[model samples]
Target: MSSNPASTPPPPNRTSGDRDATQPQETAEREINPERDHRCESRRGGTVIIEGGTVVTVDDSGTEFGEGHVVVEGDRIVAVGPGSAPAQQGPVRRIDASGCLVTPGLINTHHHLYQWATRGYAADATLFGWLTELYPVWAGIDEEITHAAASAGLARMALSGCTTAADHHYVFPRGGGDVFGAVVAAAERIGVRLHAVRGSMDRGRSHGGLPPDSVVEDLDAALAGTQEAIDRFHDPNPGAQVRVAVGPCSPFSVSTDLMRQAAELARRNGVRLHTHLAETTDEEEQCRAEYGRTPVEYADDLGWLGPDVWLAHTIHLSEEGIARLGETGTGAAHCPTSNGRLGAGIAPVRPLLDAGAPVGLGVDGVASNEAGGLGEEMHQALLTARARYGPEALSVRDALRLATRGGARCLGRDDELGSLEHGKLADIAVWRLGGIDHTGIADPVAALVLGRLPKLERLLRGGSVVVDDGRLMPVSEAELTHELDRASARIRTREVSA
Candidate 1:
């Protein structure tokens, strides 16, 4: 853990496709509006206005405002109208969005934030090979290392215009410090909304599972920890920053009994359930070998398919499985980048969506998806769907939908978040389309997904500006980088080398 800068060089901080390290960090703590009235305590902070932008409201009607403004009072958006409209009757802080495309903040439905330290370790490996290589290293993670990696991941996501992310941290190695708490702490400090799933793996290689025994926990321990996380952090309030879910890794790595019990526990607590399913043909084979059923069928029998449950990387599903998922209102977290990276086939996203299933975008884990941002994932989703199916299969708007509204539905937060609408939580992202990557794009909203990703000009969560001018407001990039380097070094030296 040397403080020497050369010992661990800082990674590039790219806001978009371009590399610009010269952006000012001056607005890290700048108030939205200093002169605004604060007499109304309910407004929390006074009104802040985003003026002169093309607003892309991913609402039910696909509303788009040509030149509009969004007025925020406290944590909710009070008004959205033409930019020419006069400001409301109150002291306000105005953000000039003249050359911006303002859209609802992107949401990430699945992630493994702790994998930030081990991003490229398995770059050339397949899913199972990659997991085998990294399990030992990940098992050695302590609380401090987990915090560092999670903080870095959240900050990186925030810079890319992500306001909320659902993380699946399933590895709980013996003696590894508070894995769940570390993720929650990092998200809170980075000012991103978090859905922290207490993921578990009960069946190990000793029991014919994919994961090593060292990283697996007993069912009782997993159940107890899941409830403890919910009791301590699952907030049901509107605009809540943190919520907890129970996720027992995957069908290949968890016991059938654990899976059934986890679902029961999640339903009893009224919390959500998440896990990986049908990511690979090998997974399907394993499920068939063990349970005499497909992954989807096994999950369904265990009561894992429902509105309260969302599965990640459902790539190898059958038509029957697809119909069952859609019928049960189950959601899917589509990880296009990770799937492509690991040589996993393109997920049937188009068919899944067409089947009346909720589909959302996920970066998966940084291990498989080095780009690890919803901005990049959205573009990847577009390309992968088109690469397999025709270009007509998915639109830029469709990708944007998966990143915003679709993600909200997967996380069961559609009523409170996900769109640019009145009374919705003011989680917004402003993209500067004036950059080199976005030039000559007729539609800024379409440019966001079709063109090279635009720079994230600003990001707001709960009506508060947390990322301004493509820089994170809540955490220091330099400090996060330093800690991440230290943690990564520790894992490489102490664990990877072992």
Candidate 2:
């Protein structure tokens, strides 16, 4: 990567009184006029000028502006520079981001939105044990339950500053009534971009798999459902609100035939492939016992290693597996918090980045990682990497990049959604760092990644405000909470009756 002209070295720490001296002239000039600003009003197809903030682009050159501005025209970023935006001709919505950090909206590379209703169960269980305990409960989910759970999950993600999320929904119970479509509907309702991976599991205990037979699909049914999802929701166009991917759940729960066929199906439709791989030693042992090879080698044999593929967890990869993934341009979703919760070993994030593999952070699932917020993943990833490797294994900027650019690479949306650059979608996040939690932090990026996750001031998705001033704009939190409670109770009731 080349050097960025706007980039600046980390500033010296200062008292709250001295912080104002660091502001640029343009930033100091702008003041909030509630009547004129209309801070969080809808911005569809309009010009939005956000100035007076620390701008971290996370672009190829690692651009950082001490105090800068971003101009959004309609759904795309029109300009980004070191000072206030140039004058605009028509009526414009001006945001006085005087004490905020502006950057590209965070992307979540992996999640299980449907698991939101299943949190707090199997809290002390290992990966396999947790799956065993939850499979029966998940077998009762219908389209209504899935919609409620996914809506609550996505609302939490938006509150945490994520603009785009990739949800891997694999559990399809009998007579679920379009459970996959419910996930898509929840994304639309929440107003965030969705990479809905139509995941399938075909192997059951009868076939030596982890999940029960009731939760598994037949081979033909799984393929047909995946194809239907793609035909209904996959959008190849840029700035798409929803896209579909093919995912056969995991090596332990999905048959060999399903895995190979799913990969072929994804490639045929020009969509991406995702799955769980090398997440635990148990999974590695199971793969070796069944296929006489490591997880990565088995995937390689099935043509699952490529740029269009990203595997989740990836905590137990061998050095050779890591090298192969890098050489093949495969992506990895590093879920640091979830790994630590399940006692899974730390993922080789630094090694993966060094070997040219794209690595992004993930909040694996609320079931294991109860918090399920994407912002804190950066902090967890940094500490875990340094604790396992060395202090220099990851940096604050590197962690931020993992959430933004690296995630885009994993989801194959690097061209449109990652960085704050011209011609890119206006999916931006403004975090308020002037509060007590982040007031004294000198470097804004460090304040964001190293300190507690700052309160989100505003989150724009495709130039529309989804979260404003730490509140969700599209739906009520109380409503989602109520619906989630009902969904959890319904699933639990079905389990009890069975």
Candidate 3:
């Protein structure tokens, strides 16, 4: 097979995570490298053939699997074919995937992982009302609370097969906690490939935004903080485990001048940009009232429309807006779970895809969805798309692609993290398909996407196991539960005070 890339990220260096998992073309003593082999502690030569499952390869042609086997030599997928035997003379680690489906690791295009603590607080309210209720709780946050929340949220995503995620966390309560940096640290420790968008909001209630006074930043302070975070944590490598993007809150919550300034900073610093756009009617109303333009037009005017930018919950886009997004190559993160829970209108996903706009799936903030699992988001995405179109319009295959390839495109990281091809990073998830929901189904991918909240079997990033048997491998479940409870108790008392 040719080694030409199907979809690649723009020029930056590829990092360690993008290590080619394929076997080399030699009987070869020349293959040994101290840095890659000795320092990394990675195994070589042995093959891991996942046989017995239908492979859901979301490639250019679409889902095509006929009783295939994926040969993993080292950490990357070397060859995928019809249950082929390992041609080389080495021990093969075989996995029974006969009834299961082999898919790329799911990707979360946008999230606020720290918002897990805010769940169930304003369950029945609209977006703005809900934000108003939860912002104070968020404003009073410390590093301990925010880190725990981020860690817990990432652990949940890992257990659900999300190998990669982008988080847009815009809250900055003044305690020198560095919420954005802490989130990056949490994701790294948990072994999830993360793009931490250094998010900021400069407009408080005094500035006609919904957020409280304590959490908002000054415009210059926001830009400086973002720059510092990016310089410290953002890796411009292909296989980088951690990357930083700039997120200047949303249309209503930040000034237009700040938005443009943030975009310029991102381009100058060589990173990406993200934000919340057209999520609800209130946002649309604000854009119309304040900017005298639709949300899309306003974003375009602020220099926020481009391939490097991805907006969350673009559910309220007009026809002209859709065309503009298509023309500009901007991306959208379709948060089906949040949309359904909040009664936000279903996004026109069909039209967006048809128009050549990049659209990916996000679980959104747990406060809105009550849970953040990539697999659950996949289920929600397909269900929501089927609701908007016919059941057949958005297939289980398409939904999976949105979580993997589609998301990579949104983050402008398609070259490195999206697929299970030869050169792509060995970021993967394995699901054990053995229960009532998966039993009668012949296709495991179908069962996975359609099943009623099935557990994620395992998750691997950079060929390292982060989640094993439905639990985070590094941390104890009991300890996690205890910390979660303790954190909840403290936050509960604080909420009562507020």
Candidate 4:
């Protein structure tokens, strides 16, 4: 595979290791302004100019600009270069990015947003054990609670600098309302780009699946619902806020027939496919015992390996499996924190990248990870790679790339969402590195990945600010917190009674 070119040149006559002296040194607070209606069609994403920062463009060319500017006209970035951007012909909202590290907004390749209310339930369990302990609790979720959970989780990711996220929600109880619709509403309310995967588990214990009978769906019903979701919500337009995908829960939790049908449906509708795969040794053993083939082989047999498909975890792959994934152009979503939390072995991220497979970062579900921030996942990915493959296996920029471009590739949206470049959507994040926590840091980019995550001062999706001054814009943080707390209490009350 070819390496990305150095798009932005370093300081003139400076050595490679020299600190970029032109980086801003102080952060000035901005006064609160009245909330603007970001959803206005007339706005069409109004013009914005972000100037005076070190821009890290995780583009095909690894661009880094010391003292640069980005000009956003409407929803797309029009220019990026050193010094001030050329003035637009009309009115523009100017953002003072002084003392900030500007980059494309982080992308999350996999998540179970509805699990937000069930965090910490299986704190000491492995992958299978954790799912077993929490499946019953999740079976009680209704539409209202699911919306609350989705809103809370999406808001957390937005505040942490994520602009686009793919959520895999597989648990569906009878009369539980439209779980997919709930998350879609939540994403819209928060103004973050969403890739909603219509996930299903059609095989219960009687059918040898991991989930109980209560939460599983019929195969035909699952396929129909998936197609309906695609027809109803999947948007193919560039810079769209909501798109849909098809996801079967996992090898252990769904049937081979369901997997094939989900893949077929996704292809039929021109959407992507996603699932959990090879996350644990137990899963590998289950695939071997049930199908007489490894998970990758089994998936290949079912026509499930390709560019349009991305699997979560992927911690237990063999060399052959890795090669097949790369050859087939399949994607992998590496959830470092959740794997560590469940005692799952580290994923072969370096090997996956080296093999040319599309690899990205995922926080997984809140129940397994207990946290949903991409910044935390970036830190964990760095530490885990070092522990398993030596200190130099993963660089700070590499981890950040996984969280940004790698994730966009996994979701098949790299064309517009991953990087801060001309003709790309204006999904950007401005993180303040001038705080005391970031003191003495020479390289702001390295500090963002290796040091404690500094404050995320501003976040924009399509040139509209979703988080400003570290506060969520569309919904009230206090209200979201209270709603999630109430939903959690409701679930606990039902669990205690059951």
Residues 178-226, candidate 3, lDDT per residue (tens digit)? 6777788788767788889888888899988889889999999999999
Candidates arranged by lDDT, highest first: 2, 4, 1, 3
Highest lDDT, which number? 2
lDDT tens readout by residue for model 4, 1-498: 223422323322112233332323223212234364533322345567777678888877677777777888788999988765665655556666766788899999999999999988878998888888888888899899999999999999998889999999888888889888999999999889999999999889899877889999999999988988988998998878999999998888888899998898888788999998889999889899999998889999998899999999888999999999999889999999999999999999989998899999998898888878878888999999999999877887888899899998999988897888899999999887755677677677777888888788778889887887787878889999999999999989978886
Clashes of each: 0, 0, 9, 0
TM-score of model 4 (CA atoms): 0.93
Predictions in order: lDDT: 0.83, 0.88, 0.76, 0.84
Candidate closest to the true structure, highest TM-score: 2
Tens digits of lDDT, candidate 2, 97-173: 76788989999999999999889999899999999999989999999999999999999999999999999999998
- How close to the true structure is residue 83 of candidate 3, measured as C-alpha lDDT? 47
Error of 4 at 358 (Å): 0.7
Alpha-carbon lDDT of model 1? 0.83
**In model 1, which runs have C-alpha deviations exceeding 4 angstroms?**
1-44
Q: Estimate the lDDT of model 4.
A: 0.84
lDDT of 4 at 309: 92
Candidates in order, TM-scores: namely: 0.91, 0.94, 0.88, 0.93
Query: Which scores better on TM-score, 1 or 4?
Result: 4
List model 1 lDDT by residue over 1-498, tens digit each. Answer: 001111222122112222111213222212233344322211237777776678878888776776777888889998887643353555666666766788899999999998998878977888889888888888778888899999999998988889999999998878887888999999989888999999999988899877778889888988998899999999988789999988999987888889999999999999999999999998998889888999999999999999999999899999999999899989999999899899989998888888888899998889898887788888899899999888767877788889998899999999877889899999999988866777666667567887777888778898777776666677679999999999999888877466
Note the residue pairs that clash in candidate 1.
Answer: none
